[model samples]
Target: MTRTNASLIGFSAVALWSLLALFTVASAPVPPLQLSALTFAIGGVLGLVWLWVRGDLKALRAVPLKAYVFGTLGLFGYHFLYFTALRLAPPAEAGLICYMWPLLIVVFSGLLPGETLRKGHILGAMLAFLGAGLIVAGGLSGVSGAITGYAIAFVAALTWAGYSLGSRRMKAVPTAAVAVYCLATAILSGVAHLATEITVWPGSSLGWLAILGLGLGPVGLAFYTWDIGVKGGDIQLLGTASYAAPLLSTLVLVVAGLASASLSLALAAALITGGAVLAARAGRQA
Candidate 1:
């Protein structure tokens, strides 16, 4: 795809992902592990169908086992913890905290060969961290369990950051890799569900809609489009643009009555977006 189209796809992925917290929260009665397993299972099946349609199903075996291992761990680890945070805390707050991944990506990208860390990146990260701090502090005042949620959300962010960074180094086809990752995540989550939580499928139409939407949109198509965008488009611009997700996510949660938008949310958005813009500028100059 052309860079413009790729960029649009990338932005679309971010927009879709912004709804993930809302959907995951809506699917609450299902429990985190089971919900993850079901959603990813659906996504994995869709991905396989996509591969078969493209005549790329044969390519899965050619991918190194190491890629599958890391990809599975990364994708699974993030979503599992992310689901936990959404359950334990307000969706808006948890969503913002989890978005630390983009900032982490900007910083970690410098660790690659011949990549230089710039002042703007450092500055931006600090600002973003401060914004995250404000969010956490604000969240803590509202709920007793917010601390644990924030901590898990941060870990989720770190997992995703590592995933994105590691993804850039792999030569495997992105969609195929994501398919394997989703399948592996589903298996592990299923095992975890059996060991811990009761398996309860969504019974309500609203709950089922949320699960299907998450599986098809954010979990399935978004990953493929994101891989295409990051691999083919302006990485800096996409990275910067993704800062909008938290703001948009918070707005969605508020409008849906899942959470209230507060002053902390606005300030956090500004700081994080500012930092992301700065980091993007540094990348462009580099």
Candidate 2:
């Protein structure tokens, strides 16, 4: 496929991710690790079905164990931290903080071999960080748990940014490999949940549907499309487009009555989105 097509495929992940906070919130009371296990297992099954349908099941054998290790760590680490953050803090605040991955991706991409760190990238990062700081500062006044969640969300952002940039280095890896990653993540999450978390199944059908939605959309196909995008498409452009995720995610929460609309969140969203735009412009100029 052309770079344009690949990038568009990647963009679809962002659209899917817009519903992440909503689904996560809707799948409530199920502990983070347990939720991760269930959703990722569903996601893994979806990937397996996809590979079987495409006659690419054999591709898994050619993949390096190290690649599996890397993918598992990336997928598991990001989602585990993200789910925990949302569980501990307000979904909107935690989600916005986690969305820093897009800005981080743009900034971190500068460290790649052919990319340069322009002034605008730095400026944009600073602006976006200020927005994050605003959230952190606000969290401090709320409760200790909120502050902890925000911190975890920040780290989750870093984890995903590093993972996305690293994916570019593994361009030779097939997209089908993400299936293995999902299954591995599910296994890891399952072990962790069994060890630490009490099993709390979704209490209602709506909760089950939310978990299914996450598995099918954000956690499932999003990873595959993202792999294709980062490896074959314009990474910087995708990073810029990713800013939409936070805005859309926050809006979804608000519209769903899971979160309240606040002036602070509105301002932070603007800052974060604007900074990403500035960073993208700088990348293009370079």
Local distance difference test scores for all models: 0.78, 0.83
Task: Compute each candidate's TM-score over C-alphas.
Answer: 0.82, 0.85
Misplaced by over 4 Å in model 2 are 83-99, 125-155, 265-269
lDDT of 1 by residue, 1-286 (tens): 6877876887888888789779977876888888788889888999999989999998888888888899899888898888788888787678778878877776777776556778887787777666655655565655455898889999999998887767766635455878988889999999988998887887799999999988997877788777777666655556556666656766788899977879989898898788777876886787
Error of 2 at 115 (Å): 2.3
| Model 2, position 151: C-alpha lDDT score | 95
Query: Which candidate number would show the highest lDDT if scored against the true structure?
Result: 2
What TM-score quantifies how close candidate 1 is to the native fold? Answer: 0.82
Question: Model 1 has how many clashing residue pairs?
Answer: 0
Candidate 1: stretches off by over 4 Å: 1-8, 83-99, 129-155, 233-240, 261-263
True-vs-predicted CA distance for residue 6, candidate 1, Å:
4.4
**Model 2 per-residue lDDT at 136:** 38
Model 2 local distance difference test score: 0.83
